[model samples]
Target: MRSSISDRLSKMDKRLLNVRFKKSTASIFVLFIIFIIVFFFHPFNELTTVNLQSYPNLVDSLKGNTVISDIKIKKCFYYSSCQLNKVEQLQWRRLDSPLELYAAKPFRSLSRSMDIFNTFVFVKQASAQTVDSALVDVKITLKGEPINDSNEGWVSTDYDSYTIWKKFISKSHETFEQVDLVRDLDILFGMDDLQDSREYWQYQRTSIPVNAPVLPHLTLLKVPLTSHNKIFTEFHEFQSLKQNEVLLAKSNSLKIVQISDLHIGPDTGFCLDSSIDCTADLKSLEFLESSFEGESSSKPIDLVVITGDLIDSHRTKEFKSSILKSLSPILSKKIPFIFTFGEMDEVPLYEDKPEDENSPDESDLKVDTILKLNILNFISSLPYCYNKFVRYNQNLHGLTNYNMKVFKMPVNEETQLKLDEPAAIITVLDSENHKIDSSQINFLYRENQPLKSKDPFKLLFFHYPLPNYRPQGEFKLIGAYNDKKPLKKKTDMKFRDDIASLGYQVVSVGHEYKNDLCLLSEKIDRNTVINSMWLCYSSGAGASVGTSVDYDRKLRVFQIDFEKKQMLSWKRSALKGAFDHQMIHEY
Candidate 1:
């Protein structure tokens, strides 16, 4: 009877456990169904739709309803069922275009060939905006095209025959009436290149080519012809130097930093001779900024003279960019600065050729002149550039030939005195060809006639050292002279004698990278005592050029004291992080 009762109770407990499992399973199933219903029919979706409805134009744009198609077609045809293989075969049979023929047998220098071809297209477009837009479109269209290897499809005549470009423009026009093709290359490429058809647009300030060896197809851009189009201008506005005619200083002394042989390239350049890995351009800039920071508060840097070689030769195509990069540190400091042209400043890096052979295109004088003019226009347009555009002689051999007056502050700080006479004069000349021409020398004398009466302390700056600049008898040399031989032009003594006669006391130059010698020598005329001049060479500040690992990159600093009529100079080394071997001379 006891066993029968226990079995009945156990069966009743099992029934109760089964009922609880069924209830929990049914509850979870109901919750899952409710979650699905809430997720699909959420109020957040309706709120998003309501917000988009308020901006109809935005909704249209998001749905690809713009003037130009957001979806670019690889190849468009009038007929929907047009066979691509048939059209490609027809294009292959077409005669080779000028561009295709040029690409087949490009110039020795691939970069030069690309530059010429792109320039031709730019000229044909005749509008800066159109050219820019078209180039970008071409780059996009030929995105996967091989740069090193030739693609037969791109080398066909039909590729650049305006068939595709015309079709694109027609399609764009059909959709939108606001879009139109216009010619306007005046701002960047210059209208003069169009007017003077004899000269090609070699120095047009455009970006480098994306693809080389294979010529890119020409594409007509569907630009919006509206008043909303803002003309693209340079980042910095043109700053005149008239206000800075007289250099001002904190105290009685004027400090000038001479940085030379920057050899700045397109981007952060590679170190040519450095043992450690570094970016040449960045290191040079850091050295300059560090030197500026290490300056004495009482004698701050008042003037900066970048002697020359601001840009590297092999990469002269992007000289505008390179120059801006080189001068960034100086420009940031807001110090008044001047520039002189080096031999490599305007010359492009040409491929190796036989000494006796000559290529007409590579050695074209017109192209060279255009490049120099373009470089000058760019540099002169920058802010705080003390380069004056006024040329004493129209036929002056070089572009950067100008003079600046450095005035002395009154001893009494309380009294505002109007001083008429200048304490010193700084003359900057261009020795781009490694020699100063007779025309430049004559212009120098002509421009100095008025200021000659002031009898100011005259200092001259150029790129190349003059022949036999060192004194024969006795001279004091300061700093290292590690250069195998000073890179001087084999010119007559006329230039040296002329400047010496003009009361020039110091002739500072930059070209030899390894030499930083400052020699004070007497300038005697026919056994008679005359003024003593300082012939100084500032070492190369750029690491891209050949530099000694033992010697640190440096900048030559000049501090002129008007009261004492004295000038103190020293080398500010990058490794040393301070001034070294300070030398002083009284005028």
Candidate 2:
């Protein structure tokens, strides 16, 4: 009876085990079904089902479908007799959209007829049909224009055309109408009733009459409205010395280009002393570009120095644009550059007003200070400009007074570990007031106190010639001396002696437009030549400024060999080209 009972219990246990195995198998099958559903049928798995071959087309469809095929500017004389003349047709790059608009030719009012004119901007746009449908009634509006239900499909850009137009008009006395439409097309009436200022009209009577009608200097921009597009307002493509201080120390030799007296104005510049009718600003830019192109491959330019007179302060209403235009070549090449202030640079905007208004009031003073600060901020903000990094001493008489050091390049990784010393030092002083005061002298003495032991090659740069700077003296002269009245203020001999005592080898300046001489003078002490310094001058590069018509616009090039401790300079003429009047100095 015990054996029979045990057999029945065993049979029950087997049945229970079989039932548990079947239940576990059914649960596993349910989980597999869920996995299959998630892997192939779930909404999140749709990405995997898309064909890889169509990915590029899918991306293209998502991008901006509108394309700006062409942009043109048309000038007209009257509203009734609208004879459109295509003044400019910009060839824009497919990758780079334009950020600013500039006039290649100045818009002048008809002097003889005295008829005011208007300008029209035409933009040819093309659009691709989207997957949903065609872009229906696509419209575009300039920046700062009002957007409402009437212009529901209008696309807006990042630029503010209205503000830019106002800024441009502030520089001139010509009255302008608000930006309006000429027709119900892709045409914009940029400037309306554009008349010349009374000052310009009087000047035109004395000078040769310009036959063109008055047109506005409006800012034009062609940019994509897509969210992914980047707006390039500054020189972001170029590398700056401030970001890469090692750029100067990496090479044993350096080539520096010195351009001066740009005299850039708000409008396309007028010919000052030129015989032929030409655009001065455009010509000046061409000269600058030629100078850069004249540089040899073996001796490429690394630094540029503009010794003041960057803008025509008399017409400084559009100084920001003028400054940008003047520095285009340097900015384009991404070369490091420095500049000093000329007397014109310091002229207050209110100084041109009437006698009572000429004396700056409190508000005028504030405005002047703000303008100066804005200019300084703008210049310093440029990627390749070094003017902002200049150290200022309150005790000094002028702004932009500082010193820079160029260190010797390391031979290898091991040599770079050693204590680095400056191979050369450059000191820039402000002689804008036409004299170097005792405070600047004291500042120079104090700054050089620590560097006395190292005895590096010291070079000084300023705007005006020194008090003792004689064109023809016991010194050697290398270039032209056409300035009948050399701009030199009276200062004590102590300043000259201090420069020699401080071990300054080269003292360069730029003020006289026709003077391009490099005078080498020796400091004699008791019949012994104690020290020698090169007093050099850079000629005016702007055609708008007063210069000898016979003398072509030129740039001064200085090549410094750190290893040899020598500097070689020469002139690069606009008409005659480069390699003229070469001069050298060994320290």
Candidate 3:
């Protein structure tokens, strides 16, 4: 043999050069122990020399006896690969006292190498006092010089921006309790309107001043009044037909499952750094498990609404607990969902702080009051689902309007009359940015004069879409009155003829992400007649922002039957390839 095969190839090349010299000395001793813990134990340096550079004459200051009045910057956000394009010189100014002041001058450079900007500001605080040296002084400049190394760029004083003023100074000390101001003026007015709320209790006692400084009540984010009386006794197992209880009809077919503008937080993602995308939370829990787990779906979702910008402008509590843990399969399958808010569901109302710096409760409360206490503690930790306890008035509209009933029954037991005949009603409201508030149209015309008569199947659920259902010079302006003759109002076709004389034969909105329907005729009387209603518009299940349309990103559904009261179907499902629901119109 050729010298015994060259002695076994020279002992296999010295055992592969001693395994590549012990993997290059363990990768240079693990990059020199990560460069000696990032430069001699600087442990990622800059602990606090808080300069927070976003400045316009920097003033956030307020400290103890609290009194900053106004700041209002509103937006600076940028980070979709930071492209601002224009804005050459923005400015703002106010300073005679109510401070204000903001500047920006752009064209191209808005990001000094952008490392997260955020910036919504809004300050205001004259009393609900927890000042804790309210601070915020940033100051950086470039072509107008002044960048002086105030520790050159690293201001983060463990900020949650004073935990959104410590949960609005602990809910302004539980709204200065006197039994929560008589249960917030009995959910606003009605003891024959309690002397019309005496100018709302003199505007809440002259905006907090019975010797000011109030902060405590944060009972570490309370929530248990025995979990709101066990969610009002598990919302009477969805009140089978409460008029004292029983009348029947829990389902003659309703379905629904809407889900619009679900811009599920951390500004959702198609990458480009909006991060968190466990495959967009597994495609939003695979579209609520194929709309109530469809095996060729035969109708089971009986009600799940959502209808709003369920977050997109970052209302972080890990973006509302990753959109309620991707709607924990519609709250662990006890279905019956609801919610309405939108306008980016209490948008970027300032949050920043949660890279886990030992987060016990890094409180940033006020993404519309921490999304109404994380939706009343996730609908009182679910499990008992029948559904009713959605009262929430907070003086009529703030906690996003309410009222639901479905396929109801209870009629004349010598007319005890609780919810006499409701074969389906709904009415969620809170049309966030297409605005509303004429005290929410006089609290939905006093809760719709006790559910407007028979021909039931009402359905209103809002989140905008009324400026005569958008498109056509996109109208908007839903409220305004004074400012020395302001006027505004008009939601046109006379606000859908006052929600079609409060009987609402379907409204179902969702800030125009696309999917349409229309119908909406007009003339509400004066004999000239006309009528019609519908409206529709859902298109948004998240991730379809500027274009890449597939019907803008589906999710609608509808259904209804109530002994054929109308609308037998509706569609537009598509949340990624063949999930299909596609019909868009049905009767």
Query: Top TM-score: which candidate number?
Result: 2
Q: Give the 10-residue window scoring lowest on summed lDDT in candidate 1.
A: 189-198
Best of the two (1, 2) by TM-score: 2
Across residues 1-587, which tens digit of lDDT does each residue of candidate 3 receive? 88888878877777787778788889899999997565444412121121111211001121122333223332233322222234411222221110001111122234422222333333344432433222222221212233344544323222222212211123344433221111111011001101111111111111110111210110011121123344445454444443232223335666776777756543223333344332443454456566567622565565677777765644232232344444556765656566666766553223444545442232433335444444434433333222233323334444556666664333335745446455666667665446665666677677667764666666777776665554343322211111222223444446667777776666767666644454444444575556555666665665545533222355666666655555643544553432423222234
Off by over 4 Å in 2: 1-250, 273-276, 348-366, 389-393, 410-420, 452-455, 471-473, 484-490, 548-551, 580-584
- 1-587: candidate 2 lDDT, tens digit per residue: 99999999999999999999889999999999997665434433112122111111112322444433333434353222233335422322121111112221222222243233433445443442212122122222344545455544443333323211111111122221222111011211112211122110111111111232222232222222332233222333233334332235437887777888887665556555446654666777778877898784556777787788887767544355567667767766767788777776753323344634434443444344445445655576555566653222334666667676665555554655222355666677777457777878898887777653365766788777786666344567788877656445555656887887888877878878777888778877799988777778878888544553334787787777877877788888887777554546575
> For model 3, how big is the CA root-mean-square deviation?
22.1
Task: Return the TM-score for each candidate structure.
Answer: 0.56, 0.58, 0.26
Worst 10 residues of 2 by lDDT: 199-208
Query: What lDDT score goes with residue 219 in model 3?
Result: 8
Ranking by lDDT: 1, 2, 3
State the displacement of the C-alpha of residue 458, model 2, in Å, after optimal TM-score superposition: 2.2
The Cα local distance difference test for each model comes to 0.55, 0.55, 0.43
lDDT of 1 by residue, 1-587 (tens): 89999999988898888888889889988998887565434432111221101111111211221232111122222112222366454322221112222221223344553222311221222223222232112222233334235443332112332311211243333433344432222111111111111111122223223343322222222334441222122111213123345565657888888888888765456555547644566777778778888874546787889888888857533344467567767766666688878877844223344647554242333445556555666566455567654312235656787777776655345744233456777788877567777877887788677663455667889888887564466667777766645445555666777887887878888888777888766666798767666788888887654553333677888888777777777788887755555545564
Clash count per candidate: 5, 1, 2
Clashing pairs for predicted structure model 1, backbone only? 126-185, 127-184, 127-185, 128-184, 128-185
